[model samples]
Target: MLAADAVRVVAFAGLAAMIVAGRASLPLIIVVAVVETAAGTLFGTTEHAVLRGIVPAEQLPDAVARNEARGYGVSLVGPPLGGLLFGIAHTLPFVANVFSYLGSMIGVALIRRPMRPAREATPEKYGAALAEGVRFVAGEPFLRAVLFIAAPLNFAINGVIFTIVVSLQRHGTAPAVIGLTETVIGVGGLIGAFAAPMMQRRWRPATLTRLICLVATALLLLSAVLMTGVAAAVPIAVTLFLAPACNAALFGRLAATTPDRLQGRVLSVIFLAAGSASAAAPLLAGLLTTVWSGTATMLIFAAAVAVSAVVATVSHGLRQPAPELTTTRQAP
Candidate 1:
């Protein structure tokens, strides 16, 4: 992960240079996006795995909630800061991203504790190792439920959001207002992240998971029914208010329960499932909006999430008691 961030620093610097030289093109942008995304994915998976080593199992939830808080805090600033820097110079945002990666690399290097447990290198095939991870997750009812709930949830939420943003722009909503909507959403997430630890203590993980689905469905339906950009932002913001607790409950449990060796692969599979759906969402929303009203598009997304809510409500794995976090960390 540290190495991946180092590579990102160099990659983003190269992109900045290309832009400064007026040689940047669509293909260059595409290449940068691909590299950054792949590297970011690697960094994210490794970060989760490494957290297991750094923090005690019982404290993983609080640690994850703090991380979520920090992420939302950054989201509250990163975009507008990037935009300001971009206005100053085309290369400025890229340059700033390069520095951000460098900062992350330094943070990783400063960690004195072992990030991964000692393990002997074996002549294991990569495919076989990956399959083992997949099989492990598939066999675990909790993980399987997470996968099923998360993927479509990501798809629907992202699709509805895209439709809302695009529709807002089409209706000539002020850019500042649109930006403010994002800020409000970020604030909602930030607040949720801060409250997550308490919420986790008070509620079953399954109950929280079900509530997230139900709330998201309700908010999406409200957004569809209202069909006004700024008015819809309220429901969206309220929806985001539940996100941090859900993530901490779900992923914190995952980090606590999953074997260290399978952490990267298990997380990679789940992230890929969710991310693939997200990647397709905007495109599908665009296509849908061309043929149907924005309300209709949002309604379709709400319906999808509603089904997930039902699934989550009856999920047997979720009904089981949350996994005990008493297990010691395992060797990678």
Candidate 2:
């Protein structure tokens, strides 16, 4: 609840300040980018908390899959809407985003659950609480192994975000065309998100997770290995489709395993782990490409993700019941 309010306030203030200041500038863009990253990280943490509190143990996976679908559904709307508005005017799309954010504030006002108190430790015990959260996460064999795979994969692929955009521009794709390409990937993700529950019903989350990883990895390898013409775009686009669905399942697993009373702490810890990856991505990506050609770098990243695949394949963690899956209090 607080996080939601903070988003509206920060965004509104930034928008208002930018508008009043007259010219939109690089400084403003950098600030907004920072805020945007923070907002997404915080929102993810909030969603994890909500799932821990509201969803029952058995329903958590389906619940998270549905939430993932809903997010992509929003993406289906937001990206196209932004693209359509961008066609009208660049500044207009941002102004339009402002209105959508305002609508969110109105929706938040309508929420009935009174905001709860600090969800983890007391003020004085924060350090100990933080340590406890870290220790708890370490104790979870499943999560630990998953991260071993995911962290390096995250580390490797993050560079592609910029590298791909740069590669696209180097190939002379227009800005609008890049947006169109993104929309294509978004379409693929929209399809995958809806299909996740059906997929999960038929296959275990771990199995499903592996399948998406394979699809993404194969695509990555293809793009890097082929590196010939516009055809390279196809495989990267395929990778885009698989990433979010896999992430949704991975997070669903995490939410199921975290305790409600410690949900905020645990989720925050997870956010920190992810944020560290993102924080390092650009620098690492730049350093990597400097050491090797872009295509070689991409292939290297593909291989790194393959390491994650192997970890996921071998870890017995994926098959076991989540240790803290239920809402029960810990035994004294």
Candidate 3:
């Protein structure tokens, strides 16, 4: 996500720079988008490598969760900070974002971790290592269990409709209102993240996610009541919190399940699925907005959350009570 975010940030930055310099073009915009996406993909691959390498086998899940929490925190803070930087100089955000990639690369290089290196390859084995890892994740019980919740949670509930900002704007809401609404949502996630360790003491991470999923689902269902301004804002804000909370738990599970040797590959596969869903949902959302009732759109997202909960609940493998790893630094 950090990497993918940078792509978006740089694309915007590059575009802003062009606009500020009065040298913008359609082609340039496209190029920026392409570069950003490519970098993000690479970052995803490398990031998993770093985490999987560094963390001990028993500690992968919690590490993944903590990472996700930090990510959510960043999401919570970044937009406002980006806006502040942009306010100072049109090019500042993008220029600063480009350097972010460099910093990430530097960090990755400096980090020491125990990663499974590619086996000695025969001529026929060029990409076999990658393929092997993908297949392993595809079959792994714990990792697969996460997809049951994480994939739909992201694709349907989170990705199925316009972003909250877009949704508000579509309803002719103002920026100040959007900012306040967003802040409320971020606060929820932040609170959830801070409480995660303790939350795990009582409930499995998956259990926590299930609870969050239900609340978030209820919130979305309520959002269908959004014929008026009040109905629309609260659910969306709640989702922001719910989504991050669920994500934090899910990442923790993923890390726990992934073998140290295959962390990079497993993480990459997970990210790839996310990227694909992200690529797919906007088109679907646009299509739905054109013909589907607002109630229908809300229902679609609600169903996604419901189904994820069901999957987590019934998956004989995942439904087993979650085990909280009390030893936090078992990996680092």
Candidate 4:
């Protein structure tokens, strides 16, 4: 994590310098973007591994919830702050991000706990090590179901969000109002994060999974029905309200069941699975909007969400209870 932060500090600082010197180009921008994304992904995966090590197995749910809350809180403020900084100076936002990574590096340096248990040395080939993680996830029914549900679910949800933004922009809605709508929706996620640990404790995993799916499906459909930003905002807010708890619940189980040695690889695989569909969402949404209309695109995405919900609700793996968190963590 510390190394990842250092990389980001260098990457962002270089980009900011380029912008200030009027040396920024399309290729330079793309390279910087890739470096930053890779560094962020490394930091995130390591952070999860560190959290699992720092917290006891039984308390992983609350730990994950707190982390989710922090992310939600950042989402609420980051865009507005970045935009404002950009308005003041084109390079200001990148400069600010550079400092943020420096701060993160300092914080990581202060952590005293070992991030993983000591294990016997066993060197393996890169491909074999990677395949081990993939095989583990593939063999685990619950984890397999998570990948199955998350792929389409993320695609649909992201598509819906992109469509909403495009629709609002095309309609000539004031920028401030659009930002406010996003803020309101982010608030819902923040509140949901605060409530996640309790929800996990009270609800069975299967029940919670079904509730999240059904509610999201219903609310997404409602958002599609009402095409206006303000009208869609209500349902979008409600839909996001369930997300943090769902993530905490799912990730908590993942942390509990995955071995310490495999944490990074396992998480990488899961993240890739979860994010792969979402990567294409914006382009697909744009194409759909161009071909038909924003409203029609939304309806199509809503239908996709509905299909994912049905699949998730009925999946045998998801219906089964989550693995119990024993005193000793699961072995690799």
Best by lDDT: 1
Per-residue lDDT for 1-332 in model 3, tens only?
Answer: 45565566657666877878899887997898788768767766766655544665456555655765787688878898899997997678777777776677566556554344455465335387679777987787667777566777777654533544455666788878877766666666666665555555567666776777777788877877772353465676666655544565566566555555566777777777766766776667666655865567767777878987787777766665555443223333
- Provide the lDDT at 167 for model 2: 62
Q: 200 in model 4: Cα distance from truth in Å?
A: 1.5
| Local lDDT at 254 for model 4 | 88
lDDT of 1 by residue, 1-332 (tens): 78899889988999999998999999999999999989988888789877888888888888989999999999898998998999999999999999889889888888887776666477468899788888988998888899888988889977877888888887898999888877777788899999999999998789889999999998998998877667777787777778888888899889877877788889988998989988999999999888987899999999888877988988887776666776454443
Name the regions of candidate 2 deviating beyond 4 angstroms: 21-24, 73-80, 83-91, 113-124, 322-332
- Rank by lDDT, highest first: 1, 4, 2, 3
Ranking by TM-score: 1, 4, 2, 3
Local distance difference test, each candidate: 0.85, 0.67, 0.65, 0.83
- In model 3, which range of ten residues has the least summed lDDT? 323-332
Candidate 3: the clashing residue pairs are 13-94, 53-114, 56-331, 60-255, 60-256, 61-252, 61-255, 61-256, 65-252
Give the root-mean-square deviation of each candidate in angstroms: 1.9, 4.0, 4.2, 2.5
Clashes of 2: 0
Output the lDDT of residue 327, model 1.
43
For all predicted structures, in order, the TM-scores are 0.95, 0.82, 0.79, 0.93
Residue-by-residue lDDT tens digits, candidate 4, 38-127: 888888988886667777788887888898899989998899899899999999999999999998888888877777778658767779
By TM-score, how accurate is candidate 4? 0.93
- What are the per-residue Cα lDDT tens digits for candidate 2 across 1-332? 45654674576467656755787677877777678667766766776676655455667667776777777678768766777877875666667666766676677567555333343354538798788788877888777766676776676556665555556666687887666655665666677777766666676667866775666678877777655344556666566566655766677778667655666777677667766776687776666666766687778777767877887778888767645556432222
